[model samples]
Target: MDNEILLRLYSIYQKELYLYLYSLCGERQQAEDLLHETFLKALLALPGGHTNMRAWLYMVARNLFYNQRKKKSREILMGEQEYLSEKQTDKDLLEKILEEEKRRELYRAIRKLEQKKQEIILMQYFSGMSQKEIAAVLHITPENVRVLAYRAKKELKKNMEEFQKKSAGREDTK
Candidate 1:
């Protein structure tokens, strides 16, 4: 892309890229650093001309975020003391409790899925990737992506039904 076009793309997409990174890293400073790295890499990789510049930028940013996350995970596994303990104020503690509860519910729902189904569901739904995009990322065909998503949804529905059935049984017992 030309310098002007690249500049425009940077201006338009910088915030979005940072937000995406923030979601991944859950820290503003780290997200800003990642965003800067993404842009720098994009600048180095930019050819004089290319189609789908926006998509290319986003893809680069996403890959950078993923790579950083993987590195952080490895570091944590290697006994890095990354977790910080803090005494939350009342409002913060309340929010944290609510968030923990919601996370528990989400994890329970996800655990109901088979492994492959969970992967497909997370890529398509949580990641907001199109079937084609997911297929590309997963090294599968678009048709297969669609089929997997359908099967995953069906499995989730069945699991939800079973959970409801068990819940009702408990209520009757009570």
Candidate 2:
């Protein structure tokens, strides 16, 4: 890829790729670092010509994240203390706390799913990847992606319902 086309691709996909990485790791700094590394590797590994650049970038980014994850599995952990140390007004802190709580609930629901379903839900919903794009990245058929997404949605709904019921029961006892 020429520098011009590569620049264009970077501009087009940077935000989405960064957001996807952030969703995966829930850390902005690590996501930014991975985004830069992803583009650098893409620049070096670009073929003579290619199709589905978005899927290709996502695949590369995903691999980079996982590779780094395995390498520093114990060293790298996102701690809540970091957030606590940040300076923030009471209103902003409250909003952040509420948002974090909601995110935790959603993540809990997703984690209750099977591994494949968790992946499908994260890629399709959190990363905003299309079924076709997910299929290309996952090396599965689009139909399979659709099926998995459907099943994942059902499973997430059931998990959320159960959680709500349990929460309600606790509230009643209280």
Candidate 3:
């Protein structure tokens, strides 16, 4: 691929890849540096069978993160995140709080999953990548990706159910 093609690819995938790297490294500056390194590697070494540019880019970013982490032994854990919306009435406020709690519980459960399962869930659900694309990025079979997704979802369901039950018991006491 030429530099022009690489630039287009970078432009298209830059933000998504940056967020992905940030989620992995949990540092904005490190994520940005990794992103630059990812694109630079892509420019220098375009692999064969690279019809899936998005998947290829993700794979490159993930590899760069691994390499950098190995050198530094620094994996920053992300703090709790609360997604906020515009101002709202009391009813909307309650609903928003409930929604935020659910999101937090879900992410907490996702963090409990095995690394591969977590990767599959995030790439497919959060990042909007297709099963085939995820397979390409993870270097696994599409069927494997599908199976892992199913298992991950099942685990997440179980976790949420258990969490809700505990929450209900606590509320009952109050």
Tell me the whole-model lDDT of each prediction, alpha carbons only.
0.66, 0.82, 0.87
| Candidate 2 to truth, TM | 0.81
Clashes of each: 0, 0, 0
Better of 1 and 2 by lDDT: 2
Ranking by TM-score: 3, 2, 1
Per residue, candidate 1 scores C-alpha lDDT tens digits across 1-174 of 457766887898787667655644557788798888877887788755655555566567668866887776742111112332486687887777666645554546656676556656765665566787666655678899899889888877776667668768988999
Candidate 3 backbone collisions, by pair: none
Highest-lDDT candidate: 3
Give the lDDT of residue 102 in candidate 1: 51
Q: How accurate is candidate 2 locally (lDDT)?
A: 0.82
lDDT order of candidates, top first: 3, 2, 1
Worst 10 residues of 3 by lDDT: 75-84
Query: In candidate 2, which residue pairs clash?
Result: none
TM-score of each: 0.53, 0.81, 0.85
- Count backbone clashes in candidate 3: 0
> Candidate 2's residue-wise lDDT over 21-77, tens digit each?
776676889999999999998889966566889999998998998898889885333
